[model samples]
Target: MHVRNKSLTPLCGSSRVARLLVPSAACTLALSLSVWSSGAAAQAQGPNPPPLAMGLIVKLKESQTPSVVRLRPSVRPSDAAPSQRARLYAAANRKRVGFLIQKPTAFGAHVIHSGQFSSVDEAEAEAARLRQDPDVAWVLVNRLEQPLAGRVNTVAVPQSGGVYDDHFWLKDRTARPGVARFATAWGRIGANRSVAPVVTAVLDSGVLPNDDFSGRLLPGYDFVSEAQYARDGNGLDSDPTDLGDYLTSGEKQSNSAFSGSSCQVGNSSWHGTMVTSMLAPPAGSGFFGPGILAPLPGAVVLPVRIGGVCGAAISDVIEGMLWAAGIDYQGSPPANPNPARVINFSYGGSGTCRTGSATDTLYRQTVTALESKGALLVAAAGNGDGSVGVVGPIMPANCDGVVAVTALRKDGTKSSYANLIDGSLSAGYLGIAVAAGEFVSGSPGVTENLHLISDTGASTAVARYIRPDVDGTSFATPQVAGAAALALAVNPGLTVPALRQLLRDSATSYTNTYTTYAGSAPLCSSVNRANCRCDTGTCGVGVLDADKLVELALDLATNSPQPDFSAPAVAATSFVPQRGNGSLAGGGGGGGGGGSLEGVSLLGLLAALALGLRQRFKSGRP
Candidate 1:
């Protein structure tokens, strides 16, 4: 909301004790005694007259008692009159200062006491003058815009590889065996061993300590409050209450008035924990049986708790962004000392580009700032069932300078809920899609520690492990985030924008008719038809290929142009506008279908494989 000046006025009054001691008090007492003596006069006067004005509290002196005063406008009123009133009060009470607080008709501004003026008019004039200063971003009054206070509820779910199980994508050779092969090839070629430890920040619901992520978690703060929201004084807050669906709750679940009772931490699902585990697990833990990312053995996972147990307000999310990017907090300058090079945001809200809203502006600023700092911000494209280009990209993924990611199934088709990018749009708006994982059908694995709800609304806290199927855009985001980290590990000097461009430029190209995963049943029935074509922009440069990205980064670092890493050349006649959609029509296209084949030829492939083995040995990967 925006706040403007002209809504505030200076307050004027006299010292309270002086008024009571004046001759007026004696006269009042005499009149009261006379009225009591004459009953007829008291009856004629009716009830005692109401107070001239509401009593106002004012500070007098250290030993002096507080005095009640009435608000009164200063004589000789003018635009400058309020300043005069302020001057009077300032003089009367040596310790008191007066300010004219202005209220804005819209959005709140940064609250500040611009300056003190001698007269009410003078203060008003100064406010007006400050408003004209270009450097004065905003002038807010002395009022508080408090969000309804409430407790945040956190629900815990088992750390199963749900619908987007990474194991399926990593182990299954039948499905896009290419992705699995890429993983294996990446391990063998890039550096048979893991590279330097890359820190990845998961800015989502607060991550709890689990057997899966013990020592890997780093120290982080809760921007939600000064209190202990991250953990209680004793230990990790462990209230495991399950909250009903937000959309399905009736009168009992209305959050209209922020109440702490309805929102208790540790009473919700474990969405954040599972997502974090996917990116960085504890030293020896695994969600899908026992496989681990070769490079993750020494990696550190920084958990920036932005999302609350249930949900997060836009402000908290913005603060989380700034903190994650090592930006200033509460007027402090940027001091992350050790910032994470990769940021994973696996959550999004439904909204197109509405520039003026608080969420949009803050997001734009935060994303732009982070990108300027060389951190790749990877975000989920959202699970909404709208067309890729039209559903409006979920922000900050949709925000310029961010890597917007969508989800793909085992068959190379876009997930019904994943948002797609329009290839026809500018490169800034384009997004990439990748394999999320397999969807776990039925109650595959159940552990006895957690409770599962039966069809009849009964909850049983049994040691059951339900294997989840990986299907949402949430699962797909981490794959790209992890790949981006690998890219940075190869070339840490890459800027945020450059990394995004590299990812897009290096994406493999293909053609397939895109279909909505959440649309009409008829579309699903025709999934077997080859008529559905997948092409560039249709399936976001095809699933992410790590080997090609590393090679590109290596080329960038060495300043030597690798033939396979060469970018497409634009036709001389193609008008490349300074800031418009410009297309690169020719040049050997990027990795075809899955990735570039130029580097895969017998000799080149063998050499690249050898280099990968050398890197693995250097990086300490097994």
Candidate 2:
């Protein structure tokens, strides 16, 4: 389906877009387990593996030091006590700064340091050594990671008719006047049009080419490396068509990750499309007369699929994310031709975010890398019903360096299912709370409140608008992401972090109108709509105040047009323009506006001098 830049060369064989195919976070985990002996052994066995190639992390005991860590193969039990084994484990990881594994389940699993490698050789060398050890049972490279959102499945209705009726979120609420006053913002900021096009990457279930995306959806890549997950005939080759992910009861039983399906076992949610639409719908596809993007809204969505029928793999998500940002992936995958300035990850897993933890570290690295590329990662707080205190923190969302979002309901309060970062909550505020991720019509709560029309089923012809009446942090995330894109559209030079700060500064507070009955879903009434339930714990800044954010961005643009360096922005604007000496004003320099007999202005002088220096360097002249 209209893959962006397919006109270039086919990623694999050209015949595929001539056909279509489909398939589909950060956490640093320490995987560095090395010792001098193992390094020597691995080197002897073969040439050192490429450095920075991802590898596995092995856990060590409290008394263990990398030099002292050792292991006993699982095949035979060691006669030594548990304490002794701990020392052996410590001995195994010599010459490494591996983090301690917490509540480890197996020899190398659980609360791991996914990637704290000194070098590829060191990591593989350790793996090699561990394999040879009689005590060591396993050593897996920290290869990939999976998404933890939309995992729980439900028999959702794919609403085929108009339910949201018209573009609701895009309008200024007559009642809640501050509710995303799009009308005024659009006028002040050029009506979601006028601004330069911004590329946003959606890393989730692959998106189908639907009329709604028309000319905006870019040709995206599928990073699913597993044949089962890919659901296509093969593994990882870059045909990203969404194959509807519906599972049979028997198939669910066979799957071990979730040990039979709980929630993520239904027809493909077409989740990628939903997230993409939130960013900006195709020109004429919105409930009102045009899509959310409207008249000339020029936002391009790059769909990078990482989710499959069983949800998503963390590894695939990581690689896809890297690729989407125009960054190298696992050291391979072609660099993205169009690196996104905004990235929306509306899916995440459950876990307490420990800064030094493996997953957290990887995620942080990803954030740094993307931020350097001028991309913002807006993620979901997760749909988990689990307590943050009991299970720890929700990942990706809880991970530092993202605009984690929480959901709100139409009546105006936290959605029961959405995870929150509220100070009172066990885990605390994870992100900003925006309007209920989605609104639904039909029955009391059936059709989705937001009208999203996109491609559906394995077949491309089935274009339908499924108003998925679901609410969670995943849905809430896109609003913030879209806002970032809109803000960038206004201030092309705004830094990602500064844009985020602007969002925080402009967020609206929520009153908890939601109350729950025992054994029932939480419900919100207009009466309690002003019960404000946000704090530093649950809401990042507060609810998304779109109009206010745009106003702030507009103010920034007016006050200063130079690139923001304060968040001190670190974009790869390390970019340099080729040297040129185009004529400026006529040599006469006699115009009233340009009355200057001087040869050149200070800035112009610097430009000329820099170009001269470059020429000299290139010529190798003294």
Candidate 3:
């Protein structure tokens, strides 16, 4: 099921696309520069388009391409430019076909050409030949996979923000941890405004331009790989603008692409718009008062679109995350000048993440790589309450090194629909909680009314409306991300663990006095499933207190150095030797250097450390 905006109320009238004879220059430019392939436009608008593979994702053995040795006979492919590396490899292969970089990817993997095969047989043969090379680690065809997000079947009851202002959540006297006290923190950290904008990436559905994000949004990349799911009449280019994710009734029933996946017929959620707006809403929009990071002029949001009409794929999400953090690899997109210090995930799939699953392994490697760059990840703990039977937070969120965020109702109790982390099974990844409003019974406040782009019936006509009663863990995630940006503004050198601990330490304690549920709501766990109270073990350390979080950050920056609780790696294990035939020369199971040492004992850790240092010394990686 999708964690989405539950309701929508149209504010203004719709205009027909044909009625506008002279479209604005901006609109004309967007159309003129559209990157639709010859026939891709027709297919994108069709009921269903076959899943397409851009190429094969291949990982290279790191030792094979170490820093070039002077006056060496062996030619170093890594020394060449990324675009020219293919030709260099081809020369090394004695005239055989070689792979070209199709797109950049995370870990040691990169998306490479599948060759000019006349048929499926020819393609497989080429892949097999490439796999036999000593430099290649693994070769897998990039299949089209979908992320888990579907619409919730709920009727819309139109409500306006007239009763109370749209920014009610900004300061709710009735709620615990009511709208993070950003104002109090701003007073102390205002001097840090001159620093460069702390880039925070929002990896979700593509965003649309609006007044809320005037000068704050960076030109982000769209990672949706397929034309049909992209819904933009183009495969993957540079544009990250959200067209519309709305699906037609015919497509939902007739198209296997939409019918077979976790997709349902619904209006475009404008999810990205809602998320970014929360981070930097206009200063004095009479409706949406101000955002969490509005005071910090140096904080900007990067809108990296990982999902589209259908959901996103695991591969695309991983690629987007790495690209957002400013890691350069072989990719079509230009280098990210404004790499994000904090990345926010407002979407997730179901189920607990496994240790050795392909997706899980890839995500772990990506996270480790990002951590090396000093970036932090904040993700939504899926919206699977007792009703959905999901035991813990979903993948990526449950992945190590990510700060998973769960939701709390206005009154400071666990949200009725938020997925609770089973601490016993979570492996110490339980995350913080924030007040994402629940307008249902027993909750004290109204739902959020945020401005977002919505589809009008007429094609080419889109308008901004205030979506009422918007509630989900999807919305709760950005609060923590914006807070992280604020924290980074004060101290640019904070590590991932430091920011995580700071958020937890400054959080408000959970309140036991529920307005309506009283003593009925039990502590949420695998056994008690739904509508339960959250303890520190299951939900997080405490409710997010932006005011306290920033105060602590400023104090740490001015008074003393932040504590370092990290287990620093003693050696690099990824530099194993490569055989002459392009295979790993030693160390079985693909040169196991990047494996997680989370639960290893001190003795085991020391033994591994000694072995790793010996290997590093042998490989000459001082």
Evaluated with lDDT, which candidate comes out highest? 3
Per-prediction TM-score: 0.54, 0.61, 0.68
Which 10 consecutive positions of candidate 1 have the poorest summed lDDT?
Answer: 4-13
Model 3, 527-620: lDDT tens digits are 7655567777677767777778877877777775532212223212212222223222211112122222323323333534465454345334
Model 1 clash number = 68
Indicate the TM-score of model 1: 0.54
After superposition, candidate 1 runs with Cα above 4 Å error: 1-166, 171-174, 177-182, 189-194, 226-256, 259-267, 282-293, 331-334, 354-358, 385-390, 437-466, 512-534, 560-622
lDDT of 2 at 568: 16
- Ranking of models by lDDT: 3, 2, 1
**What are the per-model numbers of colliding residue pairs?**
68, 83, 7
Query: Model 1: how far is 383 from its true place, Å?
Result: 0.7
Greater-TM-score candidate between 1 and 2: 2
Model 2 lDDT tens row, 1-622: 1111100011110111111111111100000011111111111111111212123433332222211011111101112235434644554554343543322221123223332222334555656665454444334334322222221112223443333344455666543322355545566666443576677788876776655566777777887555554567555656677664444445546654323213222234466665666665654553413433443355478888776554454555666776787654212255566677788886554344453444455455566556645678887765432111112125676666777776555434554445556344323233676654332222322322343443334222265444333334555667777777777777766665567678778876543222221112222232222213444444456667777788788788778663432221122222121111221100111111212222323333344345435434433466
What is candidate 2's CA lDDT for residue 210?
55
For candidate 1, write residues 352-460 as lDDT tens digits.
3344433344455456546534467887765442111124345566776667776555455554434555455455565777655322223211210111111111111
RMSD, every candidate, angstroms: 23.3, 18.4, 11.7
> Lowest-scoring 10 consecutive residues by lDDT in candidate 3?
10-19
